[model samples]
Target: MGIDPTNPTGIKAFVFDVFGTVVDWRSGVAREAQPFLNRHAPDLDVSEFVDAWRREYSPAMEEVRSGRRPYVRLDVLHRENLVKVLAHFGIAGACEPEIDELNLAWHRLDPWPDAVDALHRLKRRFIIAPLSNGNIRLMVDIAKRGGLPWDAVLGAEVVRAYKPSPRVYSETAEILAIAPRELCLVAAHNNDLAAARRVGLSTAFVRRPTEHGPHQTSDLKADEAWDFVVDDLHELATQLGCAR
Candidate 1:
């Protein structure tokens, strides 16, 4: 029943994890940040700067997730970290708008070479949407930038809850007017799929072992038995029985 469209039993939609799954956020974010870092802190090691920014990512989100602080989107958390990181690097004279632009590095990610074509193929057979922890505006901007053909963009902004939260999964199902099992979440990160599975959504894991570049230590392979484990989105479309 959860087979997305080619199987006799129907699965109506596919919810994708945008970052690192469909788009190469690690490389994209680093590329976008380099020029800004050069202009601000020319002597600084931009790669380490990029890695440091990412290092703060989980902790910042955890603060919000743990309710030690109120809910804050990744964008906000990124900015908060950027300001501190830049100051520590002795980067000065940047205005608020510049800082904000740097923070949006996540939004301007480049899609994997196969991402666009794969989604086009899958869309013919399933309703495709983004289900991510990114805020709505950020996710929409990414869709526009990366040419992601999502039927709808769903994000933490809509649910005020992050993935791994049952409420977020249920809210996405309700918005799409489909049952939980009818929506499959395709992701590169196992934790994301694990969360989707807990809520009854079928999961697909597309391994992006080098997503973190040389910085990657985790998510090197699918640790859990996801419904499907493929190398990329195009492969996913093929497995779901989409032709071409």
Candidate 2:
């Protein structure tokens, strides 16, 4: 039942986990946050500020995932978290428009250096899209700004659930009119791929050792024997038989 990395014959589409796998969210956010911080919180560390904002991401999603709150797009959750992070740092003078602009840091993420070209290569062979926790608009914005060529954006907002939610994987396959076995979930997070694997989707683990920062400890390597384990999107494209 193990997948063959070199020749994954049945996989018809490759869905990516965008945040860390395709785009460098941490660096991108920090870059966007710097000017804002310089204007407002001159004493704050840009990296710490970005990290704090991101730290709230999971819990915000968990509220919807646990059904304690109804489904809301990631944009809404991010704004709410941004307000909280600002308050946590004693930043209270930011106006709503300012907050809204800063919250869009997610939408302006820069892709990994190899991402765009590799995606173009992979797209030539298989359907390529994002199966991310980000909403459709957010995905579109990121793809547009990062120059990522996705066939479609499919994920949390589409499925009404987030990653590690079985429904996200199953429903994404349904949307593509393909069986779960014919879809491969490519991600930097081991947990995301593990969840996809549980739902019968093939998995590829792309290492993003500094996804959190230079000292990041989690997801530094694949936790399971994924169908494909590679150092970057280019490597995954190569293993998937994508042409240069």
Candidate 3:
């Protein structure tokens, strides 16, 4: 679909979910861990390692979501999760510096092949930024490295809360001084869009069929009546009449 030239839905901005949505975190992490895996545990499966690390993602964030842990950044959570996964694989005690370097892999993930072009077209019409769990620095780094062209960086750290929490969605709208209905949360994850919708933000579901690396069973299609559902951001732009 071509870009749309109208703003029929009244969406003033598009806030994105970065991981697995805008950027392909699963493959990116696997790619980053390949060399290290070859050197440390040559026989280990790279995808399994990445999946294990990601599997810990929600529970770690749940600690914060439930207020059991204070609002620590996602970077800290990711690093901690990485350490645990590495140790579980018997690759522990690998130099602290190297492990830390591996943790930074999240910051260097490549954008999806369509992400840059789609975002460019979408940006021409609406304000675009990452409303992600990634901390400000992480989001900023990804934007810089990937040329994502986000108008602002806002997310978990800024709100001091995680998504699926009403605060994260509501506070983002508050920060932008836009009504919840005026801002759209665009994501490849269903749970994320559902959360955003519950808090009154308009939602858009985009397809990222390979986001979880083929075995991905969820979010293959929209489960809710989202305001916009498209195959890609370019299609989203087209639907919103923001096509270029």
Task: List, residue by residue over 1-244, the lDDT tens digit for candidate 1.
Answer: 2543446436678988887888887788778888897787787777788878877877787777777888877788889999888877778878898888888888888889999999999999899988888898888888899898888888687888777777788889889999888788889888888888888888889988777887678888999988889998999998888988
lDDT of 3 at 206: 93
Best of the candidates, lDDT: 2
Task: Give the C-alpha miss distance for residue 215 in model 3, angstroms.
Answer: 1.6
Query: Which segments of model 2 are wrong by more than 4 Å?
Result: 1-8
In model 3, the clashing pairs are 3-243, 4-241, 4-242, 4-243, 5-241, 6-241
Clash pairs detected, candidate 1: none
Please provide, for model 3 over 1-244, each residue's C-alpha lDDT reduced to its tens digit, 9 standing for 90 to 100.
3434455577788899999889999888899999889889999999999999999999999999998999999999999999999889999657988899999989989998888988989888789999999999999999999999999999999989998799999999999999999899999999999889988999989999998888889899999888888898788877766567
Off by over 4 Å in 1: 1-5
* Candidate 2, 1-244: lDDT as tens digits: 6776655577999999999889999999999999899988999999999999999999999999899999999999999999999999999888889898999989999999989999999999899999999999999999888788999889999988888899999999999999998999999999999899998999999998989999998998889999999998889888778899
lDDT values for all models: 0.84, 0.92, 0.90
What is the TM-score of candidate 2? 0.96
What is the Cα-based TM-score of model 1?
0.92
User: What ordering of candidates by lDDT runs from best to worst?
Assistant: 2, 3, 1
Candidate 3 global TM-score: 0.96
